[model samples]
Target: MARNPAPFAPFEWMIAWRYLRARRAEGGVSVMTWISLIGITLAVFALIATLSVRSGFRSEFVSTILGANAHVTVYDVGRVGQQGQLDRAIADYEGWAQRVAEVPGVTRVAPLIKGQVLISLRDSSSGAEVYGIARDDLKSLPGIAQSDQAAGDLTRLDEGIAIGSGIARAIGAGVGDTVKLTSPNGVKTAFGTSPRVNAYEVVYVFSAGRYDIDRTRVYMPFAEAQAFFNREGVADELEVMVEEPEAVNALTIDILRAAGDRAQVWTWRDSAGGFLRALEVEDNVMFIILSILVLIAAMNIVSGLIMLVKNKGRDIGILRTIGLSEGSIMRVFFICGAFTGLIGTAMGVVLGCLFAIYIDPLFSFVNYVMGGGVWDPSIRGIYRLPAELNLSDVLSAVGLSLGLSFFVTLFPARRAARMNPVEALRYE
Candidate 1:
């Protein structure tokens, strides 16, 4: 019924393929084609690589926070004293810790007394935050209980003190070394309150992976902390771990109920030092900026195809004279642009995925070539760089590359379709 075989038919594909593969002397693809293809590949690769790294960084950051800190923390609102002044502490913290642990989804609990102290080893000194916990309760801590997190004798935690690796480095103190701790909370005597200064053996060293936490944290026995902080019988608060840290928000009501009246609850999402918010903001900014870059690269497709249309003017005139429709001419150029995009995107995806998947070994090689110090744990807040390849990000990149390539190709394509055969042949 019709002379044409329909749009983008086999004949159109054959002509498009011939146009793409023919030599430049035959008025085929120019140098611009290779340039546009390479640009698209490089841009897509950079976008995917950056996304994978951001994902890995977020994953490690959140993991460190959850491992080293409580999913939900329960404390007392404190009671008004006889003088109408408030004195705050979680009274009978052990009892409340047990009660909260009974709630479903709660995995572990520790009744702890927390205080700040100045730790010294000879002339070296550093400030440290101390947690008062029992030897048996050491295993209940999410981060410290891990084999990689703790070194030295965990058994002797009750007999002495456990200091963080950064504190040990700061004061040149090692396990089995004596370190002096001075607390401002002192015993009140008839004369005046005196600062509590005591020397204890550093029996173990631990790393929480978070720079702030590891640099200034230590653990003491519960009884010792109670006495050292001048609250002989009570603990500061109840630290709790749950089966699902993300679901901690839903379980806060049950925790408050279990902890009784005048109890307050907070989750790690709010309490994880404000750095998480900064990281999220950074992630959004990077994605927006990189997406713009991908767009710029896809624009190169317009430049390349425009040049191709000019070079193929004579061939286009001959085809139009032989009765080719304008739509067929446009479809032919459209296929050319799309094919370049497809091959380039494929190459970029493969390279980006491989880089993310084998990041560890690749990182090691980089660190070696740089002669170490590629990543600073103190500065970056993590010991290593990480990457996570997400399928959605890859899909988004592919869609963007192909979409821009096709859209920009239309202008040059329509020009070729509408060319006057007489003028095209007359010029040649």
Candidate 2:
């Protein structure tokens, strides 16, 4: 009759340690096994660290964009069809705007006019996207608006402007310096139209840490934008600053209910369109592609363990004949294979986290060597890469690495378990 194995003690560590020590000088553990263990360890660490860095880049990039742009945008649907009807649309828009402020989750609603415009500064001429924002609500935007200026006077008399650092650099405009703004006006009988020109002094310079926004964003009073475009008492869009960006979908539905057919509510994701879709696709693709490294490592574990099973067959047979059952023999091999995985995974988690934690400094050192790494004193921005580590990312990385390690040992352990003692002991 077979002896009953003690619960939780079937595969004890002391047995595993003795087996490992006895085989250290033997042919069971080959050079290939060591190489495979090292490979798996390195691959798992690299995947975890690489994915963390990528995640950091994605998150920082999104925050930079969201900082410059509002949570949601409300635009006149009719404005898409005709520029002439803008004057008549303001009354209906004003009524709806008031109600939007009263809606739950709605924090602030500000009128905005945006269009492409040409700007000429001295001899420098460049085309830029112009944003006409309400002077009173300017404090709501990031970078330019701050807690201190939330209630400050932001009155735009006529031609005051706030320009992004990139735009200012492109136009060579400084605070109190003037730049010419030009936009297409109504069509004429003989000619298409000429650009309506006006000069505005730069009132403020803002940086939102994104090249796209810092280079192209130009803020002006709504009245000034309407005048420049030859469309008085009209706004191109209504920008909404929500309490939370995640609430945009629900708030958008509620807004559409109020605006009905008059205006279209759009979230930041909608405004960015294909770009946002591409970002999401990129994240998923990168994750799956990077995970292949870990998979390759897991395969290495399997190869190493299979070799161990083959080399240990005779030893396993002798142990089974003496006292150890087939199940215990299997447990011995399982312990060996699992030990490799567990040790590698534990090492990888620590190494990967350390790499992530110091990635910013490492990038800084590289950038310093590149010579173009200097931050402009005037421009308040993060020239260095941003990395925000989340617990979820760490948990997923460690868990996946360990899980892969465990899975890799399963087949080899099963094979070791089912080995025929008679065939294994043929030489003995």
Candidate 3:
């Protein structure tokens, strides 16, 4: 009778499984198994969690930037004044804005007036960014219009200024409460230039969910702003919203031609490109660092396997004498490491995925344990700590962990396979 030889035979699995069991009295590699298993599991979990949070943070950052800001801003680069400000305004902004609106990808085109002001209430005072925009145009903004959140009544813009929630809180002014706005760019009297101080009712309170924007932004009626800033019949810039913001570059030519070449354009990317690049760089650096962690955990297998081979030396010699081939012996140890890697990776994936999928609950639990202050919107510029479990990121982590485990395990696995039966038996 002819019998066929198979790779990784049933006996090899049986032997490998047997060795994996911890026999504490016999002093096997039980501790090492636990160490390697825990190490790989924790390493993979950390990598996945970090990558997911990074992804979520990046997503929230980009969305906030795009939501609360102009996708493309058109500035009048015509003439610089003595004070280093754009003295010349967009004179024909309406005509050009309408032309730009007709562009295929162009969405909203609002002519705006922007200036820095100081806002003060009864006892509180803070710096503010005053924006002059029409009521219809302000309502048309996606961040405001599409929000399910209550950002006060847009109807209030007719009679009073719309202030951000942070500004309202800082100045201790609520809806219908009066707030004084003092601007450096004020009316010129006999005295060189007196600061313009004006009072307006805070009609609306809106939150952009951003610390910087909410803390400093105030919106006024376009007509009122013209009278206040003393720039009647002219606009500071044309704020444009686009359908596909990421491809904002594609519409540059049409916008330039429509707004005229004299008009300078600034995209969202132009203003925040450095920040986004920094985030990307940080993501890469963190991945590299965590990958090294995974490798170190994978390397823990080598020590355990070496000790395992030493403990099983006499058994190895006896098995070899009983006709087990070298390949069979190697496969047994390989199975040991491979099984550890597989089980650890599987458990890690489960935990990591659960963490990402339930980040809100997880953050809530952590925040509760830490007694709050887990997420600081003022510093982080976002309301929540986010996590996004990406398929690709998980796969990359898995590949790295398993590949390192298999590669590192080869060292001691090969050592066990090459043991001479006579030497092993003599030593025993």
Using TM-score as the measure, which candidate wins?
3
- Please identify which of the two predictions, 1 or 2, would achieve the higher lDDT against the true structure: 1
Model 2 earns a TM-score of: 0.83
Q: How many pairs collide in each candidate, listed in order?
A: 0, 0, 0
lDDT of 2 by residue, 131-182 (tens): 8777767766665664222221235424488777777778787777888877
lDDT of each: 0.86, 0.70, 0.87
| Tens digit of per-residue lDDT, candidate 1, span 1-428 | 65876889998999988888878788766577787889889888888888899889988888888877878888889888897987678777877888898999998888888999999999999999999988887766656767385778888888899988889889998889999999887878998888999999999998877787789999999999999999787888888889988778899999999999879988998776487788879988987887788778778878888888988899899999998999999999998888888888888888889889999999999999999988899898877898988898889878877787778788888999999999999957
Identify the leading candidate in terms of lDDT: 3
Question: What is the Cα-based TM-score of model 3?
Answer: 0.92
Task: Report the lDDT tens digits of candidate 3 across residue range 1-428.
Answer: 85635998888999999999958677588899999999999999999999999999988888878877899999877788798875758889899899899999998999999989999998889999999999998887656545554455787697999888888878788887988999887898887778899999887787776778888889999989988998899999999998999999999878888888788899999998999999989999999999999989988888889999999999999989988888888999999998898888888888888989999987899999999998889998888988988899999989988999899888888899999999999946
TM-score of each model, paired residue for residue: 0.91, 0.83, 0.92
TM-score (C-alpha, index-matched) for candidate 1? 0.91
